[model samples]
Every structure is written in C-alpha cells, then in structure tokens.
Target: MPLNSFKSKDNNAKPNRRDSHESTTRRVGVNPTLCRYGGDCRTKGCTFTHVNPPKDGTTKTSDCKYDVNCTRLGCHFNHPNGRLIDQKMVSLPDANQQNTASSRVVSQSPHLEKRAHQRHQQLSESELIEIIDQFLSKVEEFDTNDQESNNSDNEQVLDILEQNALQELRLQKFEFQSAINHLTAEYNSILSSTTDKKYNLLQLRRIKQKLERELKHWESRLPIYARRSDIIEKLEKNQVLILKADTGSGKSTQTVQYICDAHFIDEKQIICTQPRKLAARSLAARVAEEYGCEIGEEVS
Candidate 1:
C-alpha cells in the first residue's frame, strides 16, 4: 500500500478504539482518579465521566486525595477520618438523650437561673407600671413633635402659595389697568372725532340755509326768475333748447342754477360755454357769492 493509504487507515481506526473505550467506561463506571476536575469539568469531548459522589456512607471505589483534610460533606471516598465520621453518626442523640442533655445544661448553670430570679424579685410591680407609663409618655411627646413639624411645613407651603396668588393678582390688576387705559384713550379719540364731525355738519347746515335765503332773494330780483318754471319745463321736455335774453338778464348764471336745483341732469357736473373767459369768470364769481361758497369751490 502507498503512504496515503496507510494514513487513511490509521485515521479510520482511531474512532473505533475511542468508541470501544467509551462503551467500556459506561459499563464498568468511570475511574475517579482519571478525572482531575470531577463533576466540575467543562470539557465537552472529555473521555472521563462526571458525577457527584454518593453521600450515604456507602462503600467507595477510591480514596479521597485530601485524606483527613478534605472539607467536603457526605463525600463518597475512603479516608482515615471515615471511621470517626461513622462513629459520630452512630453517637447522634435520640429524643431521650436530648432531654438528658438539656437537664444537664440547666443543672450546670444554676447561678444564671438564680441571678435572673433575683433581678425579677428586685423590681416591684409599682416600678414596672411606672416604667411602662414613662415609655407611653415619651411616645406621646414624640408624636406631638412630629405633628407640630408637619403643621409648620403645611403652613409654610400655604404661605408660599398665598404670596404667589397675591403676586398673580397684582400682575392681573396691572394688565387690566393697562387694557382699561388703552380703551379709554381709544374712546376719547373716537369722541373727539365724532364731536368734530358734528361741528362740521352744523356749520355746513348753517351755510346751506344762508345760501338758500340768498338764492331766494336773488331769484325775485332777477328777470330770468319770472320765467323759471317755463324754462325748466321746456328744458325737461327737450334734450336741446335755445334761449335768447338780454346780457344782464342773468341768463348764464340763473339758468345753470335752475338746472342744478331741479336735478334736470343725471350727472353731478354741468358744462356751460361762454364766448369770453372774462364773462365766464365774472358769472362764476357771482354764482359763488350767491351760493355762499368761494369762487374756486362749489361755483367753480
């Protein structure tokens, strides 16, 4: 066979031997000396078995490594102290032995019992009652102190809250006052504007009444006023008309005023033509004077 064949054969044969060893160990039980870590071993592939030692004083297969110095309880290993442990187990006290032990302990300490009895006898019933009363009084005093401290804490909290509330109220009052002042200023401005408007309206009414009186007086004196109704009727009946009158007969001025007062035209303005600018200006000034207005204002 070649070298590779031999190597493969060796590798295959190793698992068979390992498996046989594991089966044999399982049947015959593991040897404790072969496993250094005992039950605490963490090796997954370890060939040694792991188990706790028996604890009923049964026969063991091996001796403990630490011998008499081993501190493990209920260990299933042979040691020099094993016989002593067995003797102690056999010597454990029964119920009757426990009673005898207790009696022996009491008999050995007679001074302890006598001293306790003497102390009890020294304290009178009245003294015991006094001690209990004193304890109760101290407890009451401690409770009162705790209550007083709690009351003081509560009062402090209330005082802080009251101060905060007062501060908030003052802030609100200031805000309200500011709002009221602003409103008052606005009201005063509005009232002043309204009074001015009323005054202007009264002045305009007075001017209008004076202009009406002047217009009535001028109407009677002007020759064109005698034919006012006839002119208005003719103008209303026709979209175009031609009138002939004397130069100073108030033809230009009175005719325009009549048209304006009668509302013969739907538009707010009226256009009049004159042959000369001087005549137009003079008529405008006369009309302005009659209407109680400036030359450049309503008459213009």
Candidate 2:
C-alpha cells in the first residue's frame, strides 16, 4: 500500500508520519531545465533528485516528456513517485554491451580480422609516405597518358587502398620492374645475336606490341620525363645537381635511375642520402625495385 494511505491507531503517531513523508518526498532545489537525461532516464525515468527541499514544504516534480504517450502504463516515467532514485544513480549497461557486441562482430569478420593483423604491423611513416608517393605517381601518369585517349569518362580509376599496402606495393613494384627487365632482355637478345641469326617476325611483333601496351598503361607524362635530357646534360657538366621540385615531381626515383643510366653504367656507385633511416631504407628499396635488382645488391 502507498505510504499516504497508511493510518495509525495511536494518537501519538504524528512524528512517525512526518518522518515517513520527509523520506519519501523528492527535494525541489534542483533546476528541472538543467537536468540532462544521460543515465537510465530513457527507460527508467529521470533519476536526479533536488539538492534541497522547497521553502513551501511541497515536493514539485517536473513534467517528464517521456511520460506523455507512454505505452507502458506502469513504467516509472508515467508517475511522479517513480521519477527520482532514493540513493545513488543506477548505472546503465549500454556502452559495455555495445563494446562486447562489436568485439564479437570483429572476430567474425574476415576483413576486420585482416585489418587487425595489419594494425599490429602498422606501416612506418616513411614507408606509408613512399607507398602514397608511388601510388600518386602512378595516378598522375595515368591521368597524363589518358589525355591522348578520347575516353575521358572511361579512364582507368586507381584505388589508393590497393596500391598503398606494403605487400601489394612491393608486388606491384616488382611486376612493373619485371616488365621493364623483360623488355630490356628482349632488346639485348636481339642486339647480341648475329645479323644472320633468324628471328621469328611474329614473336618480335608480339613483343613490340606488349612493350607498347605496357608503356601506354603505366607511364605518365611527368616533369621528369620532360626535363630528363636537360637534367642529364647539367649533371654531366656540373659536379652537383640541385633539383628544386615538389613532391610527386618524380625526382626521388627518376634522378637516381637517370644517373645510373648516364654516368654509373659501368663502374662508380651512385649514393643517395636521406635525412631519416626510414626514408633512406624506403628510397633504397624503391630504387632497387626500379633497377630490377635486390635491395642490398644494386641499391645499398
């Protein structure tokens, strides 16, 4: 039964009735407008209580928005008495429950599992930058080459995610270098062989077609390509060549390759230095890939 309905037979029960009333009554000093429904307020109603009782000796409960149109008649939001918690606030389980649910989902998802594995071996800043640089170079190259083709809309779309991965980046680099090596090998084979030695015309034509297609597919019209001759001439005449070019200008990879092609073809080693160890390692790895040799062999 409700405390208000209780009746004592004893005449001296005024003090007991006052104590019961005081214990049950919610204080009114707290501002209703300032109360944020951050806890179990949605399902369990407002849990906040006033800091002090009102001077008029009446417990004034605010009109809860959740109370109106409440489907469940017995829910705490539907009644004034059920609005405030007696003691400490009731802790909600939503965040912990959501985290547990998400953990389960990640464990079940193969893609997320792969990402978790990658997270353990996150790409170093330098390596990630190198991947991005190479990927952007490829993109720029494609965009430039695409200008000659009339298919503006049908231009090949490059995905950064595929190219920026360490494994995929290395694989793609190796494949590109392999293609270059194959072309060089074909040229060398044709050159070293005697003029009388008969070559298959169909095979030679196929090789030429393949080389052209590869060139058209990957090679971008870049600043390096345009100024390559000028740079080479300057380097040959001058001891130090200082190139002032922006990132993705193709200087990092192209300059070394140009030097190797022009000056260091036979004897002297071309040494490239970077500020950071990671940068040096990344640059070396890229140069090695470009030269179609192992990292320590032609690069280091």
Candidate 3:
C-alpha cells in the first residue's frame, strides 16, 4: 500500500465517527523492492519520493519540490529546520510602508539552536551503553543469518555433483556387463554346434578367454561379484532387501542382474530404477540383451 494513503493529519488525533481515509494506527515501512536505497538504507522510514505531480499545464517548476514539512521520523525529505517555516514569523512591512532589506527577519534565535545541541549531548552513560548493546545485537543476528545462507548454497551444489557422478558410473557399468553377456552367448553357441566346427571352435576359444579375463578383472575390483550367492539367498528369504554400497561398487547394475538370474529367471515382471535418463536407457538395453528379447519387451 502507498504510504500517503495511511498518513494521519496529526499523530495524536482521535478516530472520527465516519470512515476516514487516514489511519490512526497501522504498522508501516518502505517496501525494499520499490525503495531506491534498498540494502544501504539507514533511516527508520522510507527515503523515496512517492507523490505524483499535477497533469495540468499551469503547474510551475517550483511546485515540483518535495514536501519538506513531512512529520514522519527519519523522512529523507524533511525540512532542514526540522519544522515548517511559518510565513507569519517572517517580517513584512505595512501596506503604507515600503518593504526593504533592513526589515528582514531571522527564523530562529542562535541561542535556541545551541541549547538543542547541548540537550542531545547530556545523555546518561547508562542510556549510551543501552543504545550500543541494541546495535551490536542486531549486527550479530544479521551476520549469522548471512553465513547460514551461504553454507546451505554450497552444500546443495556438492549434492548435485555427487548425483551426476554416480549416474555416469552406473551407465558405464551397464555397458560393460552387456558386452560380457553378448560374448558369453556366442561362446555357448559355438560349443553346442557341429557345422564349420574348426572355425567356430577357434572363435569360441577366443570368446571364452575374453569372458574369463573380463570376469576375473571385475571380481578383483568389485566385492559384490564374489558375494553373489549370499546376496541371492538373502533376497529369496527376505521380503525387502536393503543393499547399501558406495559409488562404483557395481551394486546398481550387478545386484539387479543377480536377482533376475536367481529368482526371476522366467518372470518378465522384474523392475529396476535408475537415477538418470541415460542410465535408465543403458540398463534396460543391457538387461534386454541378457534375456534374449527386444528392448522394453522384457525387463524395461
């Protein structure tokens, strides 16, 4: 709401019987989004100009000045005298007498101004201490909130980076497992067939050697491959199995394959979830290859 809408004629004025445009009591402050000072504002009240000028052509340049007599505390447009300069106080010649520079009058006495300055300096030590304490408390609170906001932002960035890395690792694992399964199927076909036995046998030997080397290489690095039987048995007995492992532990891809091979050998309803799009596509393709079916037909 605009500040002028709630401005009272007098701070101590009583409420009228009829609905008045002015409000007697309403908590108010300058909106930061509209305030020009923003974070640099040091006053208790708004420092921006809010009034619009007349659209008529009669309005002069002098009429466009700020309302210096504004009574609101800490108002940036307040008059230098801290009060409106009454026209009556200024000296004026009579209608019969000519106005001259000698008849000019000063607005206020120098003694009154000096007295006001001394009054402000007469504050007690206790009052001074109380003011300092209040200022310090506000400063501490502002600093603490700023530090917390920065820490939260840093933590969020770290979490996103960790999730991306985990997704990439899972995709690579699926691709490697898919190649191994394809080579294994070719090796079995050669052993079971009789036509072109010599050529097929040589190719089968090479496939067997590649499969054995790949399996051994992974088994040495990943602990999950060696515990396949134990994991499968636990899954069979328990209603829900919680498999916890660090990133690149092979649990994401290998655990699903093990469960499908041991328990869901004939069941096409086995479902798996991946954290990212690429990981999901790769895992589905690899599982489909293992099952000897088109993608999304079984294990999608």
Candidate 4:
C-alpha cells in the first residue's frame, strides 16, 4: 500500500488534508547526480531526495555524471563524490538475465579476470629506468661483437619478472662483462701463433667482424668517447689518422709503429674506429708483427 493511498475518517475535508501534507514535505540534498538504478545499489529507488548543491563546494554528495540505469539520477563515475563510496568500475554481467527468474546471476567473464591481473602488475620508476638502460647497454655490447657467429657460450636471457625485475639490471651487467671477456679470449686464440702479416690480417678480419656487430652505441652512457674530439671525428667519418713523415724523406718504418704505439690503447682496439673489420684486423696484425710478435702477445 502506497503512503498516498491512506484514508481519513473525515470525508468532507479533502482540500485541508492535501494542504497539510504539502506543508510537511521537506527538500533533501544528495550526490550532485547520485541517480542510479537500485538493482546494484545499497538502497532501493532513492538516489537522492530534492537535492540542492552548495556553491562553496562544501556539499557532501558528488557532482558526478548521471548513472542513467539508476532509479534516481544515474551513474557518475567521474564526478566529485568525496563522501560517497562508489565503485571504481561498473561491469554489466555477461549473462542475459533480464527475463529470467534468476536475473541476478551474472555470468563470469574472462575479461574481468584479465583486467584484474593487469592491474596487479606495476613497475616502479627506478626499476623501469634500469631495465631500459640494461637493454640499451646489451644492444651496444652485442652490436660491438660477433656474438651472432662465435656464440659458443652465450648466457641465457634473464627472465625479467615483476617481482624480480630489479635483479635483471644487476644480472645483465654481469652478463655484459662476461661476454666482453669471452670476446677477448676469442681474439687471443686467433693471435697465439701467427707471424705472417697475412695470417695476422686474416685473424684481424675475424676480430673486426666481431666488433662490427657491436656497432656505434659504444658511448650510450659513458662520455669518454664523446668528449674526445679527435676520436669522435674518426668514429664519425670511419677514417684513420695518419701522421706525415718528417723533412722531404720517405716514411720511416718507425712512423707507422710509432703511431700504432701512441693511439692503440688496447691492442685489440688498434682498429676499433676503422669502418671495415678486415681493415682494422689487418692493421692490428701488421702493428703486432712490426713490434716483433703476434698481436695481443705483449710484444716487448
């Protein structure tokens, strides 16, 4: 029975009864647009009651968007509902339950499970940057070597999981250093017994081929190469720096070896700047030969 249908004993006073009812009615305030269907609501058929919003923004209810499915105003997800404990996401049930007696039972959706899982995974800023740096560093290091061809002992790609992602950065650094050591050993094996410049050149080519894969990402972080002007110029142009002979004479045997001694910081890097692996390799071999032993043997 509706409240409006209540009957009174006085039959002749209908106009007075309605006026008395109107005087007792009160204006109520609610969430700006808290009108939503009571099907999913905590309360039924009453999103609000004659709600009036405060101007100074001191209102208790939200001024959110309309929740049209609601019995009152409707959905207002993006609304400013500070006091209202609203659901973050509203998903309709997958089952077609509108006409059935058990219309309340919604089908479970795989999409909802996936969304939950996705939200569970989150990476912090430090860990995120470290992962990026590690990847870029690997790209540089591998690009510098011929690991693609002489990969007798390549380390496994670290499993970067959400829980252990920080370990990946440290692990990759270790792996990077290990790879460099392997490459150095590979170079050593080729230079162990070669006296002839041709053999030296041949071995050097192999080394150069390996280094070519390392590419130009050498200083992706360190500024050592970037700060050196002469080295930078050579790296950019793929040119060799040649020191001319003195006075009007033909070049001495010592001129080449002298320069080879000056800039060849690491004997392995004698041709690091050379564009071609073969050229760098041959140069390394010749320098090693002129100095009295195979390259990389510490020719005294």
Clash numbers, per candidate: 0, 1, 0, 21
Candidate 1 lDDT over 84-114, as tens digits, reads 3334434545324433322332233345545
Per-residue lDDT value at 192 in model 4: 77
Looking at candidate 1, the ten consecutive residues that score lowest on lDDT are 2-11
Q: After superposing candidate 4, which stretches have Cα over 4 Å from the reference?
A: 1-163, 212-300
Tens digits of per-residue lDDT for model 2 on 200-240?
33234334434443453234323354565578789778888
lDDT of 3 by residue, 135-225 (tens): 3354356447645764565435566545554444344445446645566567556657777845664454345334443444343335355
Ranking by TM-score: 2, 1, 3, 4
Residues 1-300 of candidate 4: C-alpha lDDT, one tens digit per residue = 443455434465243323344543222323343222211233432434322222242323433222222212123223443322123122334234332212221222335544543432243333433543454466566555634433543336534342243333234344335444555666556557557755555444434433332222132211222223334346447655553432212122223433343344444343234455544554555444334334456532
Q: Which candidate is the best by lDDT?
A: 1
Indicate the TM-score of model 4.
Answer: 0.19
Per-model lDDT: 0.46, 0.45, 0.45, 0.36
| Residue 244's lDDT in candidate 2 | 91
Better of 3 and 4 by TM-score: 3
- Looking at model 2, the pairs that clash are 141-220
